[model samples]
Target: MNAVAGAVQALLVIGGAPLLTGLMRQVRARLEGRAGAGIAQPWRDLRKQFLHKETVRPRGTSEVFRIAPLVLVATSLVVAVVVPFVTTGSAIPPAADLFAVVALLTLGTVALALAGLDTGTAFGGMGASREMTIVALVEPTLLVAIFALSVRVGSTNLSSIVSSTVHDPSRVISPASLLAAVALVVVIIAETGRLPVDNPSTHLELTMVHEAMILEYAGPDLALVELASAMRLSVFLGLLANLFLPWGVATSPDPLSLLIGTGAIVLKVGLLGVALAVGEVFLAKLRLFRVPELLAGSFLLSLLAVASSFFLA
Candidate 1:
């Protein structure tokens, strides 16, 4: 039954990812006063990509080039399993410890960066270097934010945090809790390669980060990378949804409640995705050098939130 629940969550994340990406495009387009491609645009894109000839790397790149997409998709699929949407009763919920989740994401990132560098292209190397530099700043903030939450809940295990937050409403207004939420929001934008951090819409290679890493991928490989990206977006947003807004999550094992919980999770994720897109639409990308300053402010806010929570508690 646990496996069954896990499967349901996985499929929901996989299928919902494209839709979420499409919705964001729609939202961004509408906000900019144009009737953008409808919400199913991502699906249409993937189909076209699959049918077309894949862009290949110059010969001598070795198998890592081919394996990069698999690594990216596999890691994201694992993350989807660990993120709780409908229930705290995840089969591998313990694996959702904040540090462990970050590690999984980092592992995938390293593989992508290596693949980018292996391509031996100037653009690929530039993107990988910038991406790693950003990750160096991002990893610490993520840990600090999660550590604050763990201290308050007395456990870093996601299940416990959900229980504590859902059981008590006052925690939401607490300083630490709010700080983590804000920090994670900044992390979400950066980690997901969204606007004001990285623009997903731009084709100019000079401005790209994530796209540069996959510039050599073609066909199903590109599809996997794109799908994995959508999955990553879903996982991060789901984590935020379950972490800060834990009320609708299921504590019960009943199937009916699980069904209702699933619907609630989708609704919450969709709304968050739309809000992020709208935010991206209004903001321009930050100067590459200034990114650290923004992340540093996030770190300070997270620390302050934790300190406030500890004092208040």
Candidate 2:
């Protein structure tokens, strides 16, 4: 049953990613008073890219460029499985350690950076440089923010924290939890390339980081990268929803309960996607130099979370 449930969870995250991306696009379109593409638009886009023959295998690029897409999607797919979607615990509960989850995400990001540099294009090199800088700054806060939760719950295991919160309820409002939540929100924005940290919509040479890295990829490679980006977005949102807002996440495999849990998971992810769309709509892209400042602020929130958890405890 765990195996079956695991399969379901993986497909849930992977298959649902394109839809979420499309929904964000649709929401943005509506806000701007334009007719949007279909809500399933990303799936069609992926299919079209997969069939196109524009794939450019740059002459000097190493195996890294060829393989990064596989690694990126695979790592994030593993993350979706480890994060409990309909359950308070994962199918592989031991892998639900929050630290390990973050590490896996970092690994995926590193693969993309390496691939970017391997392509030998100016845009690729610039993207790789900026990408690593952001990763380097955000990772520490990400690690310590988990420490905030670990300190409160006595384990870095995400399942334990969610389960404990569900069973107890009071811990969510603690100064420590609140501070960590605030810090983690910032981390999520930086890590996901949303809002003031980086704009997902931009492709300008002067400011683009994420899109610049992939300027050389096309066809199936581009499709894979795009799908992976969408998957990562869903994974981060799931982490935010399932960890802090664990209300309807399942604690058991009972059919009736799973239905409620699934519905709740959908609702939470949908609302969060809406929030992301709204943020993107209202917030102008941050000046390139200001990114470090935004991430630094996130780090401070995380540091304060750690201090409060220790001192307040």
Clashes of 1: 0
For all candidates, the clash counts are 0, 0
- What TM-score, to 2 decimals, does candidate 2 have? 0.96
lDDT digits (tens) for residues 95-184 of candidate 1: 778788899988888888888998999988999998998888888888888778778788888777877888887888788888889998
* TM-score of every prediction relative to native: 0.96, 0.96
Q: What lDDT does each candidate get?
A: 0.85, 0.85
Error of 2 at 205 (Å): 1.3
lDDT score, candidate 1: 0.85
Clashes, model 2? 0
Candidate with top lDDT is 2
